[model samples]
Target: MSKDFTYTINSIFFDENYRPSDGTRITTNFANLARGESRRENLRNALRMIDSRFNALANWDNIKRDRYSVELEIISVDIDIEGNGQHFPSIEMLKTNIIDHKAHKRIEGIVGNNFSSYVRDYDFSVLLLDHNKDLGAFSVPDGFGDLHGKLFKDFIASDSYQEKFNKSPVICLSVSDNKTYYRSENYHPVLGVEYLPNESSLTEQYFKKMGFEVRYFMPPNSVAPLAFYFFGDLLSDYTNIELIGTISTMETFQKIYRPEIYNANAVAGNHYRPDLKHPDYSLTQIVYDREERSQLAIKQGKFAEEYFIKPYRSVLEHWSENSAL
Candidate 1:
């Protein structure tokens, strides 16, 4: 571990086309910044949040001791489901790389991108056709209800997405269920570990058949449950090294800085949505009462010391030993 690793932050590697190499583990917060008031301001705030958090990581000591700086790049691609010449707005697809300045080695898996349930936001527009206007109040047609599902499936399986990463991507997403173990007193959420049983998640089953090894992880105090789709063995290398640290760090960062978005009851509204019945989407429970959901978040965060950090202690320790000079 004598060699130093250079970390680059917010650097973009893709061209105007937004296509990546094969097997690249693409990570994003799914237009988290792109959605709000000012795109520039949101991006600035997002980067600042990450920068401050990275500097706050316990492993590094000071500026002089800071061997791990990050390079981050934000990119997006447009998928035209319509054959018309009109193009949709650019989708945000970001890339991150951690470099070792001393050894000149580049680390790919340190930061995995995340996307929220926003697939419907962008792709849903494409599915809304003039012919299907009378389908329902949601404006989604009959057989086309799976339009979002099909688009998501095709995107991941598409050459554009596969080629973007040097390795298969680990797609992480959220799930909600009242009967799920996390809701039970006997069970609690843990980050970086699988949560859903194979039969429980439709999204998980879909990805698994597409050659992805699906594993789910939900952080303590997390508003929604998450599923991690490992395209190959990508999770193994990442978890053994930077993945744990990154997840924990982001957990703390979001709670402190983005409480409204990251809080435990944050996703309660999703349960009641009419779209939940769509086959293209995973099933979820609507928790209308704030009190119950808040209690769940509290309990979820309570066992952090016992369940998450402690269990992954060795992985964190191992990463610390090898990631530094």
Candidate 2:
């Protein structure tokens, strides 16, 4: 049976009203920059784009209407960057935006304090996409604007589908190029491969220790050595895990578990070097490389399956055992 996936898009910018300084505008012309829309509208449009992409990739016809339906929501959008020099907005900013926007009150049902904590100090955004509406809302600490305590209380008190998604395991995936300053000390630059397991590994372990079933996947050919780890109960409808980085890892995992989830491409070559003042290759080159890797995965087929199936299952079983109280 096809599994339902809910995908949400949280923009790094929250307030459409917030505009960059005139000198800081990167576009050739600042016409649109001056006519910025409301933050809510920008966020809604972003979510729509994300939904459209998912629809195209999954092929609406291939999706099982009864078992799979896609839902989109904006957890938060951060527009202000402060302190860390990171261009992304601060978590506090997101929290403030949500409260001001009254999103907590607008959501049908809210689960817990997770959303509140998301706007604290973390620099991430979460889009919870699952067949289960109960499990759709997620917040990342630094992803939003600001954390609002009173707003959180109001949200939890609201009627959102709180029970349905209570404590559902959330997994985060970070994909990057193999060559980057963040690589570990012993990382190999020549192979363009480094074992930088998912940034969420420690978090995944913490969830497992708390009795949630967790699984982590690292794309062997991932540009940044990407990793994906999931946390949740086994034997649930959400059994199919999606690995969206390297083709080799995707094929390997799919062969073993017949996972319904897979990536649209391989590791993004320049993903790690976003700061390059002037890229040597055109953006098209990066896109082509990603496509080639995906095609290769499709061609390799069963052989690729042989590599990932057994090991993947073994690791999952081990995680379950180790995590069980």
Candidate 3:
């Protein structure tokens, strides 16, 4: 087996002129939003959702008035396989910078775990089903997310990422609804109530493939807890302000993605699940198009199958059989 892999990063190949050099179809929420006559309105509504969530999270210091806000920018990452020079959109994330109204200062920014790729399908759709299992532990065959994980690590380790951002990534995901949570004494002022899951879920195991361990922290003023995935000390890797940038930005996306939980109007609890059809369910700020999200995942999976999986199946098999993370 060939023990060599190479790629290049093209961070500037997105936005209005996002045509991939190799005819690679980029599937992202932003890409979908950019496609129609209502592109402006779509983006505008997204901004409002983020602003509203940031305000809610920063309400602690807003007793008198709004004391904080978040500024966000879309960052796109494209990769050219084997150094072929054909850029393919790989992932997209948000660079969130906090605005301290009281201090009138713009704090340093952080790369938040935002919507981007097909991996979301494995976590949200595939693993979510595992949550409903009445009698089984979460599991997947070894090397399940190995290729995806490696590709992700490569992007983060690339010069383009280090030179531009120079910061570790922080991924935030929704807690499994079917599992019970126990509040621990572990807590941070910026990262709110810490909850321990009863047991590991498939989602946790999946992220571990990409060098991200999970921490469940329900930030102040949040209705429920969130699972934060990171490579280093969740407490020490970044300052409180940077962590706030992550919490505020990702919490907004979570609320939009899984409002049945984030907007449930409740705190961390054991075995809590929201009834979407129930009258008590709160009306979400924006109606997320679940079909769009899921279909994009399908398209991305097909893309990977055609371009990477089939051609390199034997190579991937060799690597997986002999290597372990």
Better of 1 and 3 by TM-score: 3
User: Model 2, which residues run further than 4 Å from truth?
Assistant: 1-41, 60-70, 73-162, 173-229, 233-325
lDDT of 3 by residue, 44-83 (tens): 6666666666666556667753677667666666655555
Q: What residue pairs are clashing in model 3?
A: none
Q: After superposition, which runs of candidate 1 have C-alpha atoms over 4 Å from their true positions?
A: 1-45, 51-65, 80-91, 101-106, 110-112, 116-119, 122-153, 157-159, 174-179, 183-214, 218-226, 237-325
Error of 1 at 204 (Å): 5.4
RMSD of each: 17.2, 20.2, 5.0
lDDT per residue for candidate 2 within 149-213, as digits (tens), equals: 22222232323314324433233323222233234444322122444333443344333433333
- Against the reference, the lDDT scores of all candidates come to 0.40, 0.27, 0.64
Candidate 2 clash figure, as a count: 30
**Local accuracy of candidate 1 as per-residue lDDT tens digits, 234-289:** 44445432443344334433443334434444342322221232333221121123
Segments in model 3 whose C-alpha atoms lie over 4 Å from true places: 1-39, 55-64, 100-105, 118-139, 270-279, 312-325
Q: State in Å the error of residue 16, model 3.
A: 13
Between prediction 1 and prediction 2, which has the larger lDDT? 1
Q: What is the lDDT of residue 262 in candidate 2?
A: 26
C-alpha TM-score for every candidate: 0.46, 0.29, 0.77
